[model samples]
Target: MKFGYLSISINFARQIPMLNPTTGEIALFHALLDLKNIDMNFPSTTGKKKTWADGFDPTSATLQLYSGLSANGIVKAREKLKALGFIDFKSRGRRKSTIYKLLDLGSDKSAFNSSDNSVDISSDISGDNSSDNSSDNSVTLIKTKQDKTNTNNTSEKSQATPHEQKKKFSADSVEYRLAMYLFGKIKQNNPQHKDLTESQEQKWADHIRLMIERDNRTPQQIKNMIDWSQADSFWRQNILSTAKLRKQYDTMAPKANSEWQTQQPRKRVYE
Candidate 1:
């Protein structure tokens, strides 16, 4: 699908780490951000009720097309962003488009503020506020995302406190067990693996819960896939996180099944 140019604020670009969004969340947020820009340029004629004054109501299909996320991924990302206070929404009724508003990241700099909201490719963003810093404005947020990825291993838990590790959940719960199972396999591969913080554990459990309740994968199947992937020479390193496993589940499933078939000894022909 063709996409028009996107204008992202330089200040907002720098605050991404503070947002700490997942890949899907970031993608959906950018799509919405772009839509907000478009709306500011040519707003809806339906009258700006306070309920949706600064909001943009895009169809789910439009979001999927623009964000490159599946319908389910968009739903999950929307919920996550709402919880994070980066965005808010109002339901318009069943089968109708939902109105979504991007909240100010923090401080006085509202992303879509009426006074400063402009779509000039040169002056707004990706160009320059002044002549000399044109190249600096040219630095894409993609590079910043890449830099965050590279540094994740060192800084992933630096933001979490030691007390957060003391947060508890039901040990007998299937979600927690599945999360711990994945964490155990990770620790087997690397003995020094750190324990999950509260949020990490909750996120991992939620992914596993969705695998069961949403994806229709049984607990046994998930366990089998976990074992198979962790034993494989290549996937062992790559499938270190529950989110990664969930993202790659379909691709890994067939290979895992084939490997399982090969590893099983053939039945004897005769007694």
Candidate 2:
């Protein structure tokens, strides 16, 4: 991606802390903003012309270079940014880079939705609905125990509910075997790593299930990815969780293919 200057509004910048972004999240957000700018200014040289509407589709390495964050940091920070409504990701495909859409910070839209209600960013930050009445659409940054609890609860419920809904998988199932295989690899990598609870194990199994059923990955492909991710130096540390493995599958696939191909034994014939 080409370099482009960011022009963040002062009002927008002020509300960032209210969203309680981590240092990595903040840096990644700015890096995305830069990408957005680049997309708007530079017309496509070969492919379809990209606009802000089309969104940016930079690779993980590109993001790491721009944001000065590790691969793991980019993933975690991207998830946080989505939770805070700072950004959204649109999947291109299993192999293509995902398109990132930045949300309008000054809008009255809620950062996230709950089962019962939409959690407004302003109310969540200030711990009061009155902040929404302000003529200027800016979130108030106030630190309160209740506010912290509300944010944490919302984040937890959103992430946990999906896994909790997953049906049980038996030991003989491929999902279960893959989950166990991953856990075993993790233990081998770090002896001090804590063992998974029953619920945690089930959750990991569910992620593998999604990989096969939803992502259209074959059992063999998923196994290969698990093996490659676990054995690779950088991915070993970052892909400790099956969830992370699923999230990064597309990005890691090409590299894994190259690695796998190089390891194949070459046949020789006497001439």
Candidate 3:
């Protein structure tokens, strides 16, 4: 993108110490602001607020370039910002760019301090009636016995949930594995395909889950289809994604069965 400038308020900068978990996260946070500012400065015929009310809609490509992080790294940074209540992502739909909201960080500022990194959401957020804020929104709070002197200790102790030992979403988990498997298949078909960010990778996994749960394709069947399609030149490029597979599953399943049946030996002499 063109050279965009960022303007951060003093209060927003102060909040970062308690919120940002990594250097990439800090970059992402600023990148969003820079994008919004760019929108604000650009001369538009439509006299709107420069950006959408929610925030700027940045592509995975834009974020990767802006933050200097890979697809996997960008996803983790976005997650960290969301977990800290600094940002929120709003999905538009399939093949649509996602909208991001720079949340009211001031509202949750008092919850974070030099002594403790934890945010008490139960007390900060509203009643249970408003709990259904989003389809994916969930609230959980964990408090750690913190010492005022050591800031590093507080950062280390900050966990997503009280019982969870590791990050909620990990690269080694099933979700990421599914993503990578499909990603590799796509790359195999189209050797010149561009790299995908974590958001796009997760979308691939979600499509796979849809195939398994909604289309009733077994995991083994999906694996078989992946191998069969990639080995076949005509269908290799056609079967680009799980979403595409879901669309053709009904047709392909029967064809797969027919091919398997034809491959078997014929007992013509016995007949």
- Winner by lDDT: 2
**lDDT by residue for model 3 (1-271), tens:** 0011111222244454445356677768767754654444344566542322235577878878767788788778878888877667766775777777665543443322212322122112222422432222321111112233666533332112333323233443343444455555555345456767765665666665555444444444465465556556777778776566555555565555455446543411100
Sort by TM-score, best first. 2, 1, 3
What tens-digit string does per-residue lDDT give for candidate 1 at 177-237? 6677677666645645676787787777777766664555555456557766876899988
User: 78-148 in candidate 2: lDDT tens per residue?
Assistant: 88888876777876776888778666554544422212222222222112343343433221211111233
Question: Which residue pairs clash within candidate 3?
Answer: none
Give candidate 3's error at residue 25 in angstroms: 0.9
- Cα RMSD (angstroms) for every candidate in the order listed: 18.8, 22.2, 24.6
Clashing residue pair totals per candidate (backbone < 3 A): 0, 0, 0
Which candidate's TM-score is highest? Answer: 2
Give all candidates' CA lDDT scores.
0.57, 0.58, 0.50
Q: What is the TM-score of each candidate against the true structure?
A: 0.36, 0.39, 0.34
Q: Is candidate 2 or candidate 3 better by lDDT?
A: 2
Quote model 1's TM-score. 0.36
Error of 3 at 178 (Å): 47
